[model samples]
Target: MEIILEKTTKPFFKKHAGSQALAKERIGAILEREQATGLTKVKLALRQPVAGRPCFELRCNLAKLGSVRVAFILDGQVARI
Candidate 1:
């Protein structure tokens, strides 16, 4: 399996100094977890404020599955499995 990370996702990972392997692992984990929940595809967005705030959004295929718009932050990293 393969996953494509959007351009918007890059900055977050870069900011965190995340390694490629770590990013791949995190993404793969999410994909596997989602698949176990009967979802074939998912879209995830992560945003972190310069002042140390974090937020995230997750969607399954185009339908909103989870929205943590301003509650939680995500480290930009993605994988597929």
Candidate 2:
């Protein structure tokens, strides 16, 4: 499996939550898991948008720096983050 970053909403998503790399890692984990589990495709709706389109939202728990929400898109061997 592979992931393709369509956009880096970090500059915008960071305004509210999570870091770019952190969010990407978390999402990547989930995506990888899904693929391993035989899940072909998935689309998690985020409260944000990418280029006027909906995005997949992710979350992180810093326990110190606080938490954040990441919005991205994922597809077969390619994803947008």
Candidate 3:
């Protein structure tokens, strides 16, 4: 699976993450883990479809940043964050 960050994700990180780089790194780590294990470690909740593809909310907790939640839609082998 591939992770693709959406445009709004930058502002989201600016507001909720202490370090945007770290947050992105975390997302990359999640991607790596998922690709390796074929399992999602972060909290994922199924949501309504967007453009006919199923959506999901991925929740991550940053040590000093509290919980950061991002909604994404899956299209083929890519996840649009």
Candidate 4:
């Protein structure tokens, strides 16, 4: 299984530097364990749920993200759907 992450806003990081570091540490651990193969190994990996689950739902204007690459609009450097 692949885990998808939504890019966080810059303002948020600016406000929570210490918390962000801790989060990165925990995330790194999860990604390391998740790299193992097989159901048993996968099941044994450390599991941590997002504090605010489904932090962001990428939705394109009008409807869902379209087939074309243009579906994603770049806001300066940040990409938006």
Provide backbone clash counts, one per model: 4, 5, 0, 0
Per-residue C-alpha lDDT of model 1 across residues 1-81, encoded as one tens digit per residue: 355555665665585563545555445555557557754443333443523533333432211222212112333332312
- Colliding pairs, model 1: 27-78, 27-79, 28-79, 55-73
lDDT of 4 by residue, 1-81 (tens): 222224634454476554544443443344334334221222211233234221122221212222111112223223232
TM-score of 1: 0.41
Those runs of model 3 whose alpha carbons end farther than 4 Å from true positions after fitting are 16-18, 31-47
User: What does the lDDT read for residue 37 in candidate 2?
Assistant: 76
Better of 3 and 4 by lDDT: 3
Top lDDT model: 3
lDDT to native, each model = 0.42, 0.57, 0.65, 0.31
Q: Per-residue error at 2 for model 3, in Å?
A: 4.2
User: TM per model?
Assistant: 0.41, 0.43, 0.56, 0.30
Candidate 3 per-residue lDDT, tens place, 1-81, comes to: 566777877777667656876666676566555546754654445655677866666666655766777666656567778
Q: Candidate 2: lDDT of 79?
A: 61
**Which segments of candidate 4 are over 4 A away from where they belong?**
1-9, 15-17, 38-81
RMSD of 1: 12.0
